[model samples]
Target: MTTKTRAAEIDALLKELYPRAEIALRFESDFQLLVAVILSAQTTDVSVNKVTPVLFDRFPDARALAGADPAEVEEIVHPTGFFRNKTKNIIGAAQRIVAEYDGRVPDTMEDLLTLPGVARKTANIVLYNAFGKAEGIAVDTHVFRLAHRLGYSSEKDANKVERDLMALFPREEWGALTYRLIEHGRAICDAKRPICGQCALADLCPSAFTVNGWREQA
Candidate 1:
């Protein structure tokens, strides 16, 4: 089959596996979501979720976060790891949002990039989830790993992998597809040891029972 055909099959399988694929990180507002995503880097969604309640309660919005005490922010976000840097980026991002965007999280990719710690991955998450715009697929660690293992892309770089996926899947499925891939990664196609036997996509996955010494493990 052609790459497009294979990609379509993978997409279908993922949709079946995750009928209600959604963002796991909980947030009520755009700014809150942006802050949550920033804290999510190098950390789990569960970890970010745990600290956000206190963080948001302390600094409710852009205006509040912009003037938040760095020490206080660090203490709250300490569980997410990289507390010092994340505190800096989250506060800096809030300051920029309040000053430049009139206290609203920038909806466009270009405007969102202006904020600190807002890279394509984080920007894509905020844009798609907050603004309902699918500018590009959010290639996080799970997406990156699954994209390569599924024969979607051989490129090691996340951007390149995202480009390959964008080319494979239609634009409309970009955001939903990303969430499904991430969920699948967590459920079955893990980094160290994928449970090929229980995986729904095992038959279609190029690396199934082959990659990462699955044959020996299985």
Candidate 2:
């Protein structure tokens, strides 16, 4: 089958399996979502969610966060890992938002990229979840692993994998596709040991037959 056909099948099966797939990071506002995504780098959604309540309670908005003590921020977000760098970037991003965007998280991808610690993944997350925009696919570790294993892309880099997915899938499905693939990765196509035999997309997945209880066959 053609890549496009395979992509359609994958999308259909993923939708069936995860009709309610979404950004798992919990937040009440765009600013909170932006902060959560930034802290999510190199961390899990559960980890980010765990720390956000305390962090948000203390520094509720960009204006408040901008003036927050770095030590206090670090103390609150230390569980997310990379506490020091995350503190600096979140604080810096807050300062920029307060100064330039009137304390609002920028909606555009280019503008979002200007924030400290915001990359394409974080920018895409903010754009899609915060503003209902689809600038690009959010290629997190799950997406990166699944893209290659599913024969969607041979590229090792996240940006290149995202480009390959963009070429195969329609623009409208970009955001949803990202979350579905992430869910699939977490549920079945795990990096260490994929439960391919029980995977919903096993029929369409190239690596499915090769995966056993432990890992993908060489």
CA-RMSD of model 1 = 1.5
Q: TM-score of the candidate numbered 1?
A: 0.96
Q: For residues 98-157, could you state the per-residue lDDT of candidate 1 as single tens digits?
A: 899999999999999999999999999999999899999999999999998899999988
**Clashing pairs in model 1?**
none
Model 1 regions lying over 4 Å from their true place: 212-218
Quote the lDDT for 169 in model 2.
94
Give the TM-scores of the predictions, in the order they appear.
0.96, 0.96
Clashes of each: 0, 0
